[model samples]
Target: MTHVLILGANGQIARYAIDLLLNETDAQLTLYLRNANRLSNLQSDRVSIREGDVLDLATLKEAMESQDVVYANLSGDMEGQAKNIVKNMEKTGLKRLIFINAFGIYDEIPGEFGKWNQRVIGQYLPPYRKAADIIEDSDLDYTIVRPPWLTNEDEIDYEITQKAGPFIGTVVSRKSVASLVVKMVESPGLHVRRNLGINKPNTNGDRPAFME
Candidate 1:
């Protein structure tokens, strides 16, 4: 059975990943969040709950132990969190990582969507970019996922760009993102050391639908 540790368990995308792992694979999960009580419905034999911050190295180190895969779905001060995860993983010799950062981190988005995203998230991308830098520099088997504006749809229709062209499409469903994460965990070497941009197939627009 695959053993996975999910950081930022409280986030919506992470929750989706947790459910997919528990329901779809013979996977044992250690769910980490700042508040364990928030995970009221996820208790099960295959799941263990841990409450702590990823920035807390001691706690993060402990969580990384015996974990075959590490999936981080976090936001805010992500550079610090990435540093913490990378440092501890190096110490523990844990290699596989699936990290979720947003689409604009690489300045890859094009057209009005790119402009809108930049105007909207100008303040958040610096640290996220730094986070990507840290992970890319590390020797870990890492896939840096840059998903477009997230939607709540359940459909898995998505497209992938491997850092080769302009990031197409405007929004991607969280379910689609979870599917990719699950795929990577179940098959460890699927996209090792690659940066992937995930988006909906035909949803490309001037901006996210919500704003237009």
Candidate 2:
């Protein structure tokens, strides 16, 4: 069975992805997180939990060994952690990665909404941008999924855009991002070394609501 290691396993999107992978695939999953206590509720024979910070290279190396793919859904200190992950992945000879990043990292959004996004989330974009650059430069086959503001809604219907194309909506469901991650892992050929923006397609002319 394919083995996958997930960083930031306690995150909302990561948890949902874990659930989807558990249900839909027979892969062995290793969940790496700083707080193991938060994941106490998730018990499975195919899942193994590792308590460690992503910034710690030794720990990351230990967790990454023998894993076929690594899915990083990390926040806070993401750039440094991503660099460490890349370095270790090279050392371990594991060449597949799927990164969860934010939509505004590319500065590709247009109009007033784009300006508004820059005003609000702009300060945080640089780190993710740097992280994306690191992944792009690495030898590992990588897929970066950039989602707009996240929501708790349980739906998997969303559209994706490669490169600088706009997704046309403000927010997407966390479950949808999770589903996408699982699909990416199952089929790595679909988005290797490509960055994609994802959002729920607008059904009507009404303004999209922010995901809570």
Best by TM-score: 1
lDDT (10s digit) by residue, model 2, range 1-212: 88999999999999899999999999899999998999988889999999999999999999999999899999999789989999999999999899998877878887767787788779989999999998888888999999887789878889888876765678789999999899888886768888898888872122246422
Question: Where is model 1 more than 4 Å wrong at Cα?
Answer: none
Candidate number with greatest lDDT:
1
State the displacement of the C-alpha of residue 12, model 2, in Å, after optimal TM-score superposition: 0.5
**What local distance difference test score does each model get?**
0.91, 0.87
Candidate 2 displacement at residue 79 in angstroms: 1.3
TM-score of 1: 0.97
lDDT of 2 at 141: 92
